[model samples]
Target: MIKVYGITTCGSVKKALSFFKAKVIPYSFVDLKTTQISEETLEEWLSKQPLLRLFNTKGTKFKTLNLSKELSDEAKKEWLLKEQLLFKRPIVECEDGALLVGFDEELYLRTFSS
Candidate 1:
């Protein structure tokens, strides 16, 4: 099953969920506000995508924390593990085990339309 991770208030997350609903693709939503992500899950995402990709540098949480690019990978990971809002919205676990971060309509069409 496809599982999406993000808070309901996130626009990107809303877009992703809407895409799935419009496509008639089945998916489970995991609200980041309620769910806790584990180290193993973060490690798995990092295995598929880069640490920078998983990190949300543009979000309010990042700006609020005043994170810098100089932060080490370990430091970033620690922040992500502690702060769920720092995750890029709508992290989708695709059926094939690929992790999709954020929302792009073209990419969504290509990935899910198949």
Candidate 2:
């Protein structure tokens, strides 16, 4: 099953949920607010996609926390674990071991159309 990780109120996350629903694709929503992502799980995602893709450097949380893009990979991971909002939003872990981050309608259509 596909597990989508993100907050309910985030626009991108909402779009992702809507996209799945509209496409009739099965998915389980995991709210980041209540869910604490483990280091292992994060490592898996990082292996698939770069940390910059998953990390939200423009989000309020990042600005509030004063995060820098120059941060090392390890430091980025630590920040991600400590502050969930630093995530880009809607990190979808597909059963095929694919990690989809953020909302991209064209990509989603191509991915789920199969």
Candidate 3:
């Protein structure tokens, strides 16, 4: 099963959910605000995706925290653990163990469409 992680109120997450629903694809949602993401899970995602891809640099959370000034990769990882909202919306953990961050309709169709 695909496991989607993000806040329910996020527009991106909503779009992802709608896409899956429209396609009749099953998925489980883990709300970041309600459920804490583990370091192990984050590490697994980072193994597949670049740290920059996982980081929501354009987000209000990043701007509010002023993370762009100067921060090492280690520091950024630490901040990600401390602030789950700093992650991009709709992080999808596929049944095939692929981790996808953010929403791209073409990518989703190519990846998950039967």
Candidate 4:
């Protein structure tokens, strides 16, 4: 089963959920606001996706923190743990163990259409 992690208010998350529904793909949504993501899960996702890819530098959260300046990988990791909203919406962990950071129709089709 695919596991989707993001907040409910995010448009990207909604789009991802809609795409899954339209394709009849089985998925479980994990709302970040309600259920906190564990460090273990963060480590697992980081293993598959680069720390840069997982980090959302353009989001409001990042803007609020003003993290655009050069920062070490450890700093970024700490920020990610401190602000989950700084993560790109709808991080999808596919049944095949593929980690996708955002919603791209073509990529989704290619990954899940089998």
Candidate 5:
């Protein structure tokens, strides 16, 4: 089963969930707001994709927190651990060990199309 991690209220997360439902895809949701993501899991995601891709620098959380774009990768990672909202929305962990960060319609079509 695919594991989707994100807050339910996020627009991109909603879009991703809707896309999955509309396509009859089975997925389990992990609400970041209520659940804590393990360091091991974060490290696993980092291994699959660049930290910048997994992090949300343009989100409201970023702006509200007044985070600097010039922050080091390590600093960003630490921030992510402290604040789950710092993560990009709709992070999908696929059955085959593939990771998808955020919602891209074209990418989703190409990736999940049967």
Candidate 6:
């Protein structure tokens, strides 16, 4: 089963979930608003994906926080830990230990299509 982490109200998260449901893919959703992801888990994801990919720079949360775009990797990671909304929407953890951040229709099709 795929593990998807993000808030439900996010448009990208909604798209990802809809795609999964449409494809009949089995996935478990972890709402970031209700659940907190640990630093260890975030680090694991960061190892698989670039920090910029996992960290959402364009989101309203980022803008609202008035964070500097030139933040160092460590600073970014610290901010991510401090705010769950700073994460890119719909981070998917595949059974093969692959991590995907955000929704891309083509990527989802190629990866999840049976």
Query: Using lDDT as the measure, which candidate wins?
Result: 5
Q: State TM-scores per candidate.
A: 0.96, 0.96, 0.95, 0.93, 0.97, 0.97
Per-residue lDDT for 1-114 in model 2, tens only?
A: 999999999999999999999888899999899989999989889999999999999888999997787999889999999988899988999889899999999998888898
User: What is the TM-score of candidate 6?
Assistant: 0.97
lDDT of 6 by residue, 7-114 (tens): 989999999999989988999999998888899998899889999999999999999999999999999999989899999998999988999899999998988876
- CA-only RMSD, every prediction: 0.9, 0.8, 1.0, 1.2, 0.7, 0.8
| CA error at residue 43 for candidate 5, angstroms | 0.6
Off by over 4 Å in 1: none
How many clashes in each structure?
Answer: 0, 0, 0, 0, 0, 0
Better of 1 and 3 by TM-score: 1
Candidate 2 vs candidate 5, lDDT winner: 5
Cα lDDT listed for each candidate: 0.92, 0.92, 0.90, 0.88, 0.94, 0.93
Give the C-alpha miss distance for residue 11 in model 1, angstroms. 0.6
What is the per-residue lDDT of model 1 for residues 1-114, given as tens digits with 9 covering 90 to 100? Answer: 999999999999999989999999999999998889999999999999998889999999999998897899999999999999999988999999888988999988998887
- Residues forming the 10-long window of minimal summed lDDT in candidate 5: 33-42
How far is 36's C-alpha from truth in model 1 (Å)? 0.9
Ten-residue stretch with the least lDDT total in model 6: 105-114
Candidate 5 or 3, higher lDDT: 5
